[model samples]
Target: MGYDEVARSVTERGELVLRRRTGTDGPAVLELRANGVFVMDTAEHSSEQALADAALASVEQPRRVLVGGLGLGFTLDRVLGDWRVEHCDVVEIEPALVEWMRDGTVPHGRQLLADRRARVIVADVATAVAEAGPASYDVVLLDVDNGPGQLVHDANAALYDVPFLHVVRRTLAPGGALVVWSAGPAPQLLADLEASFGHAEEQTHEVRLQERDEHYWLYVARPAAGRPEASAAG
Candidate 1:
C-alpha cells in the first residue's frame, strides 16, 4: 500500500491531518488524523455504523436522535437510513472537522451534511447533552474518544463519568437508549452506565482492519422506570 498527503490544517482542538492512501490493489482511501492520533479512514467503519444500529434497535419508532462526534458522518448516515428517524442532531467539537465535510475534504462528507434530517452543530457534545430538555430525544449515540482508558483529549474523560451519565439519562425520553462507542472494552464505563441508568447492556463488534483484528465495545443503557422519583430521594 502507498500513502499520499492530501491536506493538513491547524484547528482549535489540535493539528488536523488529511491524507489519501493508495494500495497496489484497491481504491484510494482518505484518512483523518488529529494531533498525530489515528481517528479513522474511509477504508472501514463497521463499528461506527454499528454504534447507530445497535442504539436505534433498542428504541421503537425513534423520531429524534442525538449523535455526538461526527466522524466522517458514518454514524449519522446510519441513523438517517432508518425511515422512522425524523431528525438527527449531531454535535461535533471541531469546526475544522465539519468544514472538512462541508468542503469536500472527505468523499461521503457532502452527502451527510446535505441530508435534511441532519442538524450539525459545531460545539462540544457534552454541552449539548447538558442543555437538552428532558425527554427530548429517543436515542443518544456517543463516539467521542477512544475510550475512558485512552482518551484523545483529557476533557473527554468527563463524558464517561457518573455525573454526565446522569445528565444523559435525564435528557433522554422514557425508555430512550443511550449508546456509547469505545475503541475497546471498558468495564468501568459499563458500571457507570448501569449506575446512572439502572439498566445497561453492551455489544461487541469484531472487525479486521489494517490486517489486524480489532474489537470495539458499545454500551447501551436506559433509565429505569420511575428513575426521576428514585433520584429525588438521593
Candidate 2:
C-alpha cells in the first residue's frame, strides 16, 4: 500500500518500472520490474554477492572482471570491494537501469559507479561477450536472466546456450572463471557448462529473505584446459 512509483520507462523491449515501498523501519526498499514481471529488488541479494565471490575466488589474480547484468549493483559492488581487483567492466542491456543507477534513482547506484576502476557499458551482454578479445578478463559473472527456466525475457535464453558460452569462455584469461546466478535449479545448465568449460559445479544456496528462505543456484565453470580448484566462498 505504501509503494510509490519511482521511475518508469517504455522501450521496444518492454516496459520497466521502479518502485519504492516504505515501511515503519529502515530505508525504503526499491524494486525493479520489467513488463510487469519482477526482476530484482534491493531487499535480498546474498546470491548476487555469492556470484562475484565465487568467480573471484576461482581465479588466481582476478584483477580484471566482466560482470553481466548490473541489477542493483550488488555484484559489481561486491567485486570492487576486493582490494586485489584492479578493474571491472559491467555490461547491461537496459539503458534505463543504467541511467537509473547513475542518476541516483536507484539510491546506491551513484556511489557504486563512482569507483574509478568500474565501467558500465550499455549493451547486450551476449553481444559484448562475443565481441570481447580473447583472454580479456580474469573473471566473468553473469546474472543476466532468471536462468534457463522461468525466463522473464525470452531473448536472454541465448546466454545459457552453448554458442554464447563458448564466446564467454573465449573471453576469459588463462586462469579465468565464470559464475552464473540462477533463480532455481537449472540441471541442464551443469551439463552445458561441462560441455563448454569441461568442468562444472553447482552450488545451491539458501537465500534468507525477509519473509521466507529461498533456494538459488550458482553454476561455476572454468575453461576446459583449466582444472584448478576454486576456493571456498560464503
Candidate 3:
C-alpha cells in the first residue's frame, strides 16, 4: 500500500483548506482535496474528460466554451483537444488552486494553460456566468462541485437552482449545450435542469477505483428555443 502525504496546502477565499496529496506510488497519483473532501485526483479523470467530450459532441462547430472549474485541468485539456474549440474561458473560484496548476503544483496542469485559446479566470463561476452576455458561448461545461449531493461548499447549492440555471441558459448561444459533472446521480438537479431547459439528459461514466467500480454523472441540457428569454422578460 502506498502512503499518502500532503504536498501542499493553502487556505482560499471560503476559508476552506485546499490540499494536494502525493501518494507513495509517485507524482502521478496526486489528489486535490478541499476541506477534507476529495475534489479530484490525477489518477482517474476519465469522467472529467468525458464531461467535455459528451458536451462537445452534442454541439456542432463549438467556437466558444466556458468551463466552470479548473480542477486538475483534465476537463479543460479535453475541451481543447478538439480543433473546433476556438476559445475556452475557465472560471475557478480559488486563486490558490489556479496558481497551483500554473506553478506545477499538480502534474498535467500546464497542458491546457499553455493552449492559446484557454483563458483561466480566478473568480466565482456563478458570477462569471451570470455576468456574461446572452449567447456568449456555444458550450458551458461545469465541474465545479463534487455534485449537488456532495458539495464542497453549502453555498454552491445556488448554482443548481432554477434562477442560476436561467443565467446559464442566457449565456449559451442558440442551440448551445450545458454540461455538468456530478460525483453521483442528483435527481433533484436533473429535475431542475429539465424544468429550466425544457429538456435534459443524463450520461453515466464508470470509473474503476482499486477493486470497485464507481459511476460519475453528467447532466446535459439545451436552452429551450424562446423559453429562457420569455420567462425573464415576462
TM-score of 3: 0.90
The weakest ten consecutive residues by lDDT in model 3 span 13-22
lDDT of each: 0.86, 0.87, 0.82
Best by TM-score: 1
Candidate maximizing lDDT: 2
How should the candidates be ordered by TM-score, best one leading?
A: 1, 2, 3
Clash totals, every prediction: 0, 0, 0
- What order do you get sorting by lDDT, best first? 2, 1, 3
TM-score of each: 0.95, 0.93, 0.90
lDDT of 2 at 192: 84
lDDT of 2 by residue, 26-143 (tens): 8788988888987778888888898989988998899999999998899999999999899999999889889999999887999999999999999999888878888899999999
Cα lDDT of model 1 overall? 0.86
Give the higher-lDDT candidate: 2 or 3. 2
Off by over 4 Å in 2: 226-234
lDDT of 3 by residue, 1-234 (tens): 443554555554344343444444655366677777777777778888899999999888789999999888999998898999999999998887777778776655766588899999888898898788888999999898988888888888888888888888888888899999898899999998888888899988899853469988999998776673624321
Q: What digit string (tens of lDDT, one per residue) describes model 1 on residues 144-225?
A: 8888877888899999988788888877887789999888889999998888888899888898777789998989998888
